[model samples]
Target: MSHTLLNESNADQYRTRVTLLGTAGGPPWWDGSDRTGISTVISVNDDHYIVDLGEGWGPQFRKSNLGPVGFQKGLDNVRAVFVTHHHSDHIVDLPNLLLLAWHNGSDGLKSPIQIYGPGNRGELPPIFAPENREQLPEVFNPDSPTPGLTESAAKLMEAYALDINDRMRDNAKQDLRDVFEFHDIELPGTTGDRPNEDPTPEMEPFEVYRDENVRVTAILVDHRPIFPAFAFRFETADGSVVVSGDTGVCENIVKISADADMLLHECIDMDWVDTLMGPNSPKPDANLMQHMLAAHTSIEQVGPQAQAARVKSLVLTHLVPGNTPAEKWQQAAAGYDGDFYVGEDLMQFGIGAPRG
Candidate 1:
């Protein structure tokens, strides 16, 4: 059945929108690529909410017209951030984001903004390194001395807050404590296809935080060492969309995202890489590509995954080398039965209603 789009009768539509701001490995540093690493901007009315702050992301945030003001309000509604993990590509840009958001001339947020992620939950795993161990403190809970990821996360928050507070004071901006909040989501299963992508990982299932009209669910999936990679199932008033962050072939995704309207998943070309590596005299560069080949989900993995989920459309992202030409992208994704498109940065998809 087709779901109805959610309408905020009290507010307006242009109030919020979702933009795929950055779609690269890390924010463009020297390559001059338009994409930034793994970033998504979800705007509600005029305010924007950002996901993941990869390296060099500051420039792109300004470029996307997400600078400060929203379409209606002088300052964007964007006051909150969600970080899925601590991977360099996923969070290296965070400090800059905090600095940018608190820029005096902008919103001048009165309270610390909320930053929700998995790492905010339990104690850091004993396996974490010393430098990162402090950053990944366990969440604070006097009731439970149980050293967990959250405890590690708490230590990190305290340290981060101390530093950030100093900067805010220097900038003469509002105290970050009044402006920054950290939330943690604990994903249950461990020690399987999923490992600690990092003590501070990215992601929240579709279910956790959403309006009545929207429901999100998270499922365990395989991204090999990128362990604990997620499959986000977004159910709206009208339809459902599944975003498989970055993963290899896995069964949990199929069960979680059954019957989605669209499945936007990352894609890599293992066949071509294999061909390159298999040749008698392989290029030295092919070795690295070969490793990336292992964890990332392959094109061959799509058809079956989508079919199993019964998705209506498929959008392939995180493209590997051969996706240059439209035909190549289409051809690469040809295995799937549904309508498919090659995704690019800033491409928009209207989810709720059809406008005249």
Candidate 2:
């Protein structure tokens, strides 16, 4: 199948399109709906950029129906990928996305798929004391550093070296190095400051990627102790859209999304989560609940944040209780009536278009 290449001359023919590829929060599972994990494909004409390659996103992308090319050819059309954080559910299919795209020969696939994300947190705080536990694990050590996106990608590539070698040996022209590129996001800083720390007290959005079709900016959000989770804004001539990549009620997202054409934000139904972790369940108690509150935004909070951001439309995605009926999430937009959408897998929204 012949793939259409997106370039400046024909850019006007296509309007920006945002597709909710996988709208589930925790992990990939079948719960009546086909929701996989949090993945969104933001396409400016034929240039497809994916944000958050969640678990099963590779398969989800194959079925997304974004480009003219069908099935595996569609995967090869992916221009770049942006990860919000290192959460397993968010990035479990990284290898699959990389490998499939590389192996499948699509036109204009020469440029390496650039993966951009936040750098590492220096060290992890001790989870448990040595004396308190029967067997102290290395993961609990305070001095051990959490790998950043770039480091993690390198490690993943290393783990898949044998498969990559075998494939390369079969086809001498196919090189893994030509298929992937990783970039670690860092804030401008002075001599003593950390590389990813903001230069000023007020955290602001910074440019992460730019191409013929769109300009992408990322702002640091408080998914705290998760250190640097980000919210991304993608702007094109048609309109601007913001994706809140797994965050709490974050001011950075509101700032980045100000007057955006649409805001795709994650929403959690805490009440439903609590019911799932009832007294008899094997789930962790108050601590887990506290973390949930700190890391994820409740449905009640979604409307207020969307209102504050003054976005044209609000689409709730990454549903925490993925199985909940759409009506159960409607009350989330009780006040500040704007265009509200209950995100479902494969749902497509056009940028700058009136809400349907």
lDDT of 1 by residue, 1-356 (tens): 22122333321333334456666542235243455466776554345556666655566666556555453222234565655444566667666655555553354664455665544323333342345345656555656533333354455557578667777677576665565666655565552212444422333334545643345566655554443345566565556666676666666667666777777777766655665554543653454555555556666667777777787777766555423444655664555687666666765454544432
lDDT of 2 by residue, 1-356 (tens): 01122333433344677888889988647467767888999987667899998877877766665555543555555788898887888888888876766545554365777889878766563453356468756664345367788887888889988887887797564677777788988754432133234311246688999999899998877665565678899998778889998888767788999988888999888887687564555664666676677778898899999999988888889998788888988878866477888888877766653222
Clash count (model 1, backbone only): 52
Candidate 2 segments exceeding 4 Å error:
1-14, 28-30, 68-71, 125-137, 140-144, 190-201, 277-284, 353-356
What is the TM-score of each predicted model, taking all chains together?
0.69, 0.85
Please list the residue runs of candidate 1 whose C-alpha ends up more than 4 Å from where it truly belongs after superposition: 1-17, 26-33, 43-49, 66-76, 110-112, 120-167, 189-206, 211-213, 275-294, 321-326
lDDT of 2: 0.75
How big is the positional error of residue 331 in model 1, measured in Å on the Cα after superposition? Answer: 2.1
lDDT score for residue 44 of model 2: 79
Task: Evaluate all candidate structures by whole-model CA lDDT and list the values in order.
Answer: 0.55, 0.75
